[model samples]
Target: MLQRPQANEFDSYFTKYVYNVGDKNINQFLRDQEQNIVHLYNTLSEKEAEHRYAPGKWSAKETLGHINDSERIMSYWLLSVARGDQTDLPGYDQETYVNHGDFNKSEVAALIADFQRARQSTLSLLDSISPAAWVRTGVVVHKRVTARTILYIIAGHTEHHMNIIKHYGNRLT
Candidate 1:
């Protein structure tokens, strides 16, 4: 079995999921994420997507929505960090967000498409930045954070959820 990544493995699950992405390659982790989203989407059947791994846990659909919401927020955080914003970033209430999210009513294909589009948009924004910007820092959830750290967290965060989908009461549809 693939060893689980540390609980705090990727520093911030927000960036570790997508760090070490090749600067020379445009694919740069974001594409990988889009692909993973698609892969997971395709893996689940219509009924399976609605399956909840456990009582009170998010269903596959809700998990996809979580990924979408997180990427959107993290993209903004990335931009702020790149711009050297020092203000503490706001904390998100995942449970609240999921509760308010209507993923249960959304189609699987749409969720995948939305995630891909959002990720692509974020990557486009990131690709336009100067190298110096990558070193800039910002505050996230009241903690000092850097642009690079945010990127890694993105990848690691996805990986974290992927693990859950794979083992924590979920399986390939």
Candidate 2:
């Protein structure tokens, strides 16, 4: 029963992600969202999986990879910050991550499978934390953030990309 994070607990830019969470239970959201992602991925054809809605856009596989990458990093941050680490974290370049993933030639199911596994690890990590640690804060890319905030971001970021996947995946011909 994690309460929503306060506006003052995180930087303004992250508000959209947190706001996207609304009043839902964060842990339950994470668990259900995992199933949603898997279902979406399971519905895509191999050709659809490699689709890019327009020029210069990422393929569905790449987008899925990006979500996986983000979850892994943010979950690590959640772990690091919750444990009272004060280390300043650097921001990741999404484009670089997408380019490096080479997901275009990989199986989308494999990517989605990886994401599910990583997400389970994240869920376990969050569940294992002390209740007080959820409020722990740390500096991330020069912005002060809490473990609770990152959890919201983790869920919201997936939602954001899943919207993209649905939009682009629909455009597949």
Task: Please report the TM-score between candidate 1 and the true structure.
Answer: 0.81
lDDT of 1 by residue, 43-107 (tens): 77878888886688888889989988988898888888888778788979999999999998999
Q: Which ten residues in a row have the lowest lDDT in candidate 2?
A: 164-173
Write model 2 residue lDDT over 1-173, tens digit each, in one string: 99989999999999888888788999888888999999998988888888778999888888889999999999888898899999998789999999988887878779888998999999889868999999999988889999899899899989888877777666975
Model 2 global lDDT (CA atoms, 0 to 1) = 0.89
Q: lDDT of model 1 at residue 125? A: 76
State the lDDT at 67 in candidate 1: 86
Instruction: List TM-scores for all candidates, in order.
Output: 0.81, 0.96
Most TM-score-accurate candidate: 2
For residue 101, model 1's alpha carbon misses the true position, in angstroms, by 0.5
lDDT of each prediction vs. the true structure?
0.72, 0.89
